[model samples]
Target: MKYDWILFDADETLFHFDAFKGIQLMFSRKGVDFTQADYNQYQEVNKPLWVAYQNGKIDAHELKHSRFLQWAEKLGTTTMELNSAFLNAMADICTLLPGARDLIDSLSERAKLGIITNGFEELQDVRLEKTGLKKFFEQVIISEQVGVAKPDKKIFDYALGKMNYPCKSRVLMVGDTLQSDIVGGINFGIETCWLNRHNAEKEEGLEPTYIVSSLVELKKILIP
Candidate 1:
């Protein structure tokens, strides 16, 4: 293996993070029927909050609470209550992406594995454990605990420190987001692999060391 360790983004890259389904499940427990319109409304509020979060303009708590504030007030619950329920719902539905387990297992033999996610603390651990994929990683770094989100170098610095500061070139960052995962890894002076499964438009000026449509393809690159 060329790299000492491989770090991954949790949601979308390793697992299917169905936020809309999670919200629907959460509301079902509350005896409310969450509809397509409801999901659209939720995204209208939630998307920009995430952008603010990635830009470091807001902290995780603010991002978590603010997105659910409207629903919290409408349901007579606290933002914390709504947000926690949402995360629990997400955990209940979490599933690994196709080839995630195979890819992780194969790479684990050649490189130490880790996760660096901008996802909240509530869902990260539970999902990993429930999916039976928790044993593969040495570190699971959540931005909420680190006080810095991805695309910022501090979180990567913290991750490298946890890995005892291995050579940057020997660390591979694999994630789906162009800005946080690709740009952040580039800025941090490490190699990156973009898991562009949907063939999404490449963002201007951001380049990844490798791009693959699926983990199966990535497996070929790393383990072939």
Candidate 2:
């Protein structure tokens, strides 16, 4: 099918978080002696804070500082030192997923490419620029910048509005998360492609128009 525009998710879809996790683990193990349980607890606390930030219940600075503070409290570590370590670890590990840059370079020639991510605008922009993927995107709509998150439909619609494209069949949304990318795209009446990198089972109620195991598969399905 011919598509006029394509929206991508930033984290797992383009920027692999697993690499970041590894760096975090390495740093935490060496610096603070964090256990697996501590890391898991940190994620559990951090994710809900992000969700709250997405919903506009909390600001970005608060979310970041608070998550780090809470994690340090649970681990009985120095909050100031741990916070600095977290920032440094994250900064040191910002990298793109495999085939990300090449896929974006190929797709940009065919359709308008952009990113719709639920993340801090500053952080996402820095990561994109660092990974050398920023130039390919016509626009990058971050939830922190837009004050709304995915699956809300408004965020997707806002991205379409920025692209000046009609909300029609010519648009496609590609991402890893079913709750965000697939559900939001379907809600906005656009084709949805689920990037199931791990080959996880699909939920019963949600569906995607296409499923790709890798970004390279996008070229097979989307016509130039």
Candidate 3:
């Protein structure tokens, strides 16, 4: 077999997270009474929290709660209300990217499929369940659930451990982020496939074994 297990990233790779950004902005404006400045501030604060979460310096609940608290303080609002609004907004708008379902369906018959995401377990579960994409994956490993995130190598090892497959060479890591997916896969000694949806220029020191503009292209590389 060309590949045994196909591991995937959730957000931006399979899910259209950019589509939810506008919804988040709308929620901040209406539900949280947030200004443009406050919205920008929240993103600034949230990014680092995710990095810390990935680094294992903090846990999922702490990261989410702390991000909300930080944003609430910046906006002079209650953290409880902001957190509620955030969760509601996320739940309302979370959706899969174009061709995500079709691609998964096509690949499942040919290769064992799984999700390896650096996201909160509950939230990722909710998104996958709501989007109807959860059924395709034989296994789902979230960083929060495993206590390790991408780019650290340990998380990839954990996923492989769960897979219990003898052929390490017959595994591929597919995701949108170069920093996380490519780096982590390289560390794990698996092939990496980059879902370059944005056509962004590659940065220095990060590389993938394969690059495709769409999930539809996956069948060409994997099945052919």
Using lDDT as the measure, the top candidate is: 1
- Ordered by TM-score, highest first, the candidates read 1, 3, 2
Off by over 4 Å in 2: 19-30, 51-62, 72-88
How do the residues 1-224 of candidate 1 rate in per-residue lDDT, one tens digit apiece? 88999999999999999888888999999999999999999899899998999999999989988998999889899999998888999999989999999999899888999999999998888988898889999999999999999999999999999999999989999999998999999999999999999999998788899999999999999998
Error of 1 at 48 (Å): 0.7
In the range 1-224, model 3's lDDT, one tens digit per residue, is 48889999998888767523643665656655555676677678788988887777887777768877865676687766766666556766777778888888888888889999986565677787898877888889988778778888888878888898548889999999888888889888999999998898987777788999998887677777
Error of 1 at 163 (Å): 0.3
**Candidate 1, lDDT over the whole model:** 0.94
Q: How far is candidate 1 from the true structure (C-alpha RMSD, Å)?
A: 0.7
Q: Which stretches of candidate 1 lie over 4 Å from their true place?
A: none
- Clashes (backbone N, CA, C under 3 Å), per candidate, total 0, 0, 0
Identify the runs in model 3 with alpha carbons over 4 angstroms from their true place: 19-30, 73-81
The per-model lDDT (C-alpha) reads: 0.94, 0.77, 0.79
Tens digits of per-residue lDDT for model 2, 87-172: 44554577777777778888888878888988656567667767787788999998867767887778887888899965568888
| Highest TM-score scorer | 1
Candidate 2, residue 118: CA error in Å? 0.5
TM-score of each: 0.98, 0.83, 0.87
Give the better candidate number (1 or 3) by lDDT: 1
lDDT accuracy of residue 189 in candidate 2: 89
Residue 63 error for model 1, in Å?
Answer: 0.9
